[model samples]
Every structure is written in C-alpha cells, then in structure tokens.
Target: MNDRDRAPIDDTRFGAITVRQDGQDRIEVHGEAVPRVTLERDPAAEADPQIAIGTRDRSHLTMRVDGAEVDLLPAKGRLARHSYRVDVEYDGASYRLVPDSVPSSRLTRDGTHLGDFSSDGDETVIAEWREDRELRPADAAIGYALASAFGTGAQPMWMMIADGVSSALP
Candidate 1:
C-alpha cells in the first residue's frame, strides 16, 4: 500500500500528565510544561479508574489506573475522529470503555480519507495493523518530531508525519 493509503501518525507533544494523589481523594498532576487540562473521569468515578482524556485540538490519551495499559495519541489533532472500543477488567468486573470519537473536521481541514477523522472502519483496520507493524524507534521518533514541528491550523500535521516517513522509507 502507498503511504497516502495509510493512517496518519501524530507525533506532536501537545502535552502529558502523570497523576498521583497524596493519600487523599484529590489528584496531583505533573508533566512537561503545558496548559493543564482537567482529567474527566467516568460517571461511576470508581477507584482505579479507566479514563480517556481528550483536548480541544483533538489530542488524547487513554490510561488505566493500575498501569495495565496506556495508549498515547500525541497527534490526534492530525487525523479523523473514530471510536476505540476497549474492554477493561477491574475489580472482578469487565467494563467496556468506548470513548466518544473526535470529529474528523475538527482534527484537520484536509477533509476525510478512507481512514481520516470520520471513518471508524478505516481507523480500526489501521489500528490493528499498527499493532503488528514493525517500526523502528528512530522512525517513530522522527514521525513524532516532524508532526510537532510543522503543526499549525493551516497544515495538517498528520500529512507531514506521513511525508516524513515516506521520504525516509527505503
């Protein structure tokens, strides 16, 4: 498949947060210096929560309290919106964690592709491939850096990451 046919990668470091509560209900957040957005939890608010946090720019992160898994969408703003249905087992119960999909238009003005912001079917297929794809750390790092460097409202960062990877490919 051509590079254009692949799902876009977001490498921008919009920001990150590590939360810890000092033996209290309140949570303490830390990360690289950036505007702090609130961590919106599930309605249940159960301990050891499984949560997905999204930003106005379409950046998102899904994390589990017990650290069983953590997925980072560093450049979510560059791609289309799609649903991620995750199953989590906690406290002897299985909770289906399906986050609201971020709209594709909101992510970029490049319009939708087969896997762009509005195609859940395409996103799911690409995600599955990503899990099995053998990508070098350097390639991944370069993709991330390019996305961050070229970010702006006018140009889609995903496209930039794609171009970077394509040019680097043998």
Candidate 2:
C-alpha cells in the first residue's frame, strides 16, 4: 500500500520531524540535521556470526542514513531476538525493530512507541500505530533505508555478539 493509506505516526513520536522523501537517497527532517546516506558492507567480515558451521563468513548490509546508521543482522539461531534488527539513530531520534512471531514486529523511536508492523497477507506488511498519529514523509525515508539495507539478507555483526552472549551462559 501507499503512505497515504498506511497508519499514521503519533505526534509524540516524531511530530517534530516535518520532512519527507521520495524513497530516494536523501531525507530532510525539519529542525534536524540531514544525514548522509550510504550503502556499504565490510569486506573483511570473515569472522561474522553463523548458525551453521562454515569457514565462509556472512556479510551484512549496512545503510548510513544521515547521522544514524542501520544494520540488518542475520539471525544466529531460530529464536534469535530478530532475524534481522535495525539499529538506527536518525537526526536526534533513535529507532529500533523488535521482531516477534505474533503481531509481527514493533518499531520504536527514542524509547517511544511508534507502531507495529505485521504481515497483512502474502505480499504486504502493515504498520499498526499506537495512537492516532500521522506518518510523515520522513518516516517513509527511514523505512526505505531499512529495506535497502536489509534487502540483501546479510548477517549483521551484532549477531555474533548475541551468539557469544548465549554461549557464555551455563
């Protein structure tokens, strides 16, 4: 679906950002510094995380949007926190995606509730807003960044950390 038909973003979450984009490489936020967007990945990611034993390492997709960066980390295990989590910090706002088996995943900005993205059918994912909020064009920019970064299904470096943490447990 288009942005117009999508759920609205709550004012308390990102009402301050009055900018938007056309799914392009740039996003301008009102009263916030614009970030330089880039798509990059570490070539020396041989020591990245892995679920299956293999000498070859997996490279994750990284997107640098303005001041914040978004990394899509592959799932280390079946029950990994998120198959791929986006660690992002845009302008002065921070965004996170917490994936769950039910109701899909939750998106938060600066510790505030933004909305929940769930599969609507076989081809679409819908975002359910917490409050009666209006989604800004800037919000779509963030989503585009995430989609670009995670579209390749690369494994993020954080997955190794999570795996290490899990291994340390008795």
Candidate 3:
C-alpha cells in the first residue's frame, strides 16, 4: 500500500510511513500490518539503553527498513548517551542524527541536509523532513531510533555525567 491508503498518523499506533510512541519505553512503526516494526530498549544493553528495532526478533541498535538492516551506530562524540549521536545507512544512503542542543535533533543524509526532530516538551516527537515520499519510512525509522533523547526518564546516570563533562570542557 502507498501513503494514500495508509491510516492517518494520529489514528494508528504507529504509521504505515511513520513511527510513534507505544508507551514510555516502546515505539512502533505501522505499515503493511498493524505494526510493521517496533523499537524498544534492550534490557541487556550496557550503560545507556541500546534500541532494539523491528518486531518480535528485533535487534539492538539496528532497524530493518526497506529491506536493509540499518545499524544505528554511535557517531563518535564525547558523550555516553550513545543513542543521541546516531549514524546509520539505508537504501545505500548514509545518514546521521545529531543533537542541535536540547529538545531538537538534525537528520542529514550524505552530509547534505534533510530535516530536524524536535520535542514539544512532552512525549511527542515532531519531525520536519523534506517532502520526499520515498524516504519517509527510512527517515521515521532512523529518527525514532534515537528520538528518546528528548523523552522523559531516558537519560541514564552515565549519560548525564558524560554530557555534563563534555559540556564543561571547551
């Protein structure tokens, strides 16, 4: 099904072409069926929570979208909130989702530009991406994989300390 046939974003738990919060710790990407993909915190992850993307057999820090296993790697930075600075590739295109200060994030592909993700000071995540129908699903997966940086109770002790230290220097 195409975008036209898909359910409205607010009507679906997730969107056929977008991602949405299922609860505090779980998110779902709706499409094809009720939830084509789901992302949640990996209980076994060390330090900061590693995201598990996909349905029942989800993998940590990886999102299976558009037939590609996009690994959300921690883009090298001085912070331990590993998910906040994420790098991934999908449909053979490289993308990075980095923080643009608090309550906002930037998503760039091949270092060109796409859009940004910002919080409404609540549990909701809002994204403004270029009007490209083809990339919407990929963008949703990539952005939601790290969107928790703006979610409540997501910052672990290590992340707080790392961010604090990094902010103090330079």
Best by lDDT: 3
Candidate 2 regions exceeding 4 Å error are: 1-59, 66-84, 119-123, 133-136, 144-170
Which candidate should be chosen as best, given TM-score against the real structure?
Answer: 3
TM-score to true structure, per model: 0.18, 0.42, 0.53
lDDT by residue (tens digit), candidate 2, 70-157: 5434343334446555556656666766564444656667666667655321113344567765554445445433433332122344
RMSD of each: 19.2, 10.7, 8.1
C-alpha RMSD in Å of predicted model 1 compared with the true structure: 19.2
- Score candidate 2 by TM-score against the native: 0.42
Clash pairs, candidate 1, are 11-144, 80-117, 81-117
RMSD of 2: 10.7
Better of 1 and 2 by lDDT: 2
From the highest lDDT down, the ranking of the candidates is: 3, 2, 1
**lDDT score, candidate 1:** 0.27
Clashes of each: 3, 6, 1
